[model samples]
Target: METAFTPFQSLAGGALIGVASVLLMGLMGRIMGATGVLAGLLMPANLADWSWRAAVVAGMVSGPIAVMLVTGEFPQVQVPVSSTMLVIGGLIVGVGVTFGAGCTSGHGVCGMARLSPRSIAATLTFMLATGVTVYVLRHVMGG
Candidate 1:
């Protein structure tokens, strides 16, 4: 499958992520790790913790609606894989996050920004694994 080259969209999204990360850190002293945020929402320690996680999740879910309102239509998404593959990929990601202790938003953006050695290593590993996975899937498996 071919990947879409969306430089402007990518830049905008990255800027938004960076701004959100800084805001979350400044406001809550927390990293804007998507998986951690979701997990906290699912199994919160208290009502206060749950509330912030819920707000963050709500903002995440409503982004598409906000985009639709702005552009008069939802942003187009292209998922070339089957539903089965999507589910499998999600499961793999969940497993990876559990093992790696954080996701890309956390390790790559926030953690690396702070010069955390663990995050740097994790980010490098993530990129390398991603490259290898894509190569294997596209070139070797022809998927």
Candidate 2:
């Protein structure tokens, strides 16, 4: 429940994220939304663009894995729920991925970078929904 990250570590992580976002947008002219990238990979018409998207996703995934392998500093995750609950949560997230027209990474990082109004709305919705969900599940539902 408690994070072991020092203030410096947290700040460095935030800085790295910002740097990566800037580089990704400036260099690729692409939104770094994991879901959209993966969806592009799944589309037959997007075969020509698959490699870059796949690499982006791979790099994002592999970066953390590499860190854990090298430093053995994997962060702990605590989810006080059953597999069924997790599955339900996943389904809800999937729906959000579809309805929101972009995932948090896409809207928060990429859209915000482009100064998009839709992205701003989407990001606010994500924050508000997450806060409300947490409150309901932890307090109202006594989960």
Candidate 3:
């Protein structure tokens, strides 16, 4: 399957992510690692921490709502795979995150911005794995 080249949209989205992460770091002095945020939400250290985490999560879940308010329609999403495949993929990601200590949003975005060595390594590994996965799925496995 051919991938669509959405440079503008991708740039805008990436900029938003960078701004949000920078704002979070600047205002709260916290790195905006999504998985870390979610985990903190699950068991917060205190009320202040919980409130911020809740707000971050709220913003995350309300993204489509914000788009609908601005564009007058919810963003369209497409999922080509079955629910089982999605679940399997999620499980695989969970295992990877557990072993890697954080997700791409954390390492790729926040960690790299901080010039963290571990994050740099993790991001490289993530990129390499993604390229290999895509190559195998598209060419080797003929998916």
Candidate 4:
């Protein structure tokens, strides 16, 4: 099925993300990577560090709630797989993040913005892998 495309919304969201990244780096001296922030929360070394990590996680959780309150409806989410499959996919992604040293937001956005060669390579690998995975699932495996 054809999907609805909202260019304005997408552009606005991307701009917000860019601003957030810049602000986080400027004010906190931290990279705005969800995975890294969540991981830090799980294994914080000090109370001060833990507080910001907790706040980040809370803000992430509350973002959809705030949007729903403003819009008078929850955002549409389409999940094409079973819950078990979703959980498995999440676990695999966690493993991949660990191996890759960073997630997409970290390497693709922040790292590339800083002109890191490693991040550029990592981002390219991520895009290529995602494209190959989609091709394999949709055509080769007929998933």
| Model 2 pairs whose backbones collide | none
1-143 in candidate 1: lDDT tens per residue?
Answer: 87889999889889988998999999999899999999999999999999999998998899999989999999998888799989999999999999999999999999999999999999999999999999999999998
lDDT of 1: 0.95
Clashing pairs in 4: none
Superior candidate under TM-score, 3 versus 4: 3
Sort the candidates on lDDT, descending order.
Answer: 1, 3, 4, 2
Top model number, lDDT: 1
Model 1 ranges with Cα > 4 A deviation: none
lDDT, candidate 2, at 12: 75
Backbone clashes per model, in order? 0, 0, 0, 0
Runs of candidate 3 with Cα error greater than 4 angstroms are: none
lDDT of 4 by residue, 1-143 (tens): 33479998789778878898898899899998889999899999899999988987887788779879999988888888899999999999999999999999999989999999989999999999999998898889987
The CA root-mean-square deviation of candidate 1, after full C-alpha superposition on the true structure, stands at: 1.1
Question: In model 3, what is the error at residue 22, expressed in angstroms?
Answer: 0.6
TM-score of 2: 0.81
lDDT (CA) per prediction: 0.95, 0.81, 0.93, 0.89
Give the per-residue lDDT of model 3 (tens digit) for 23-126: 99999999888889999999999999999999999988998998899999998887878999999999999898889999999999999998999999999999
The true-versus-predicted C-alpha distance at residue 111 of model 2, in Å, is: 1.1
Please give me the total number of clashing residue pairs in predicted model 1.
0
Clashing pairs in 3: none
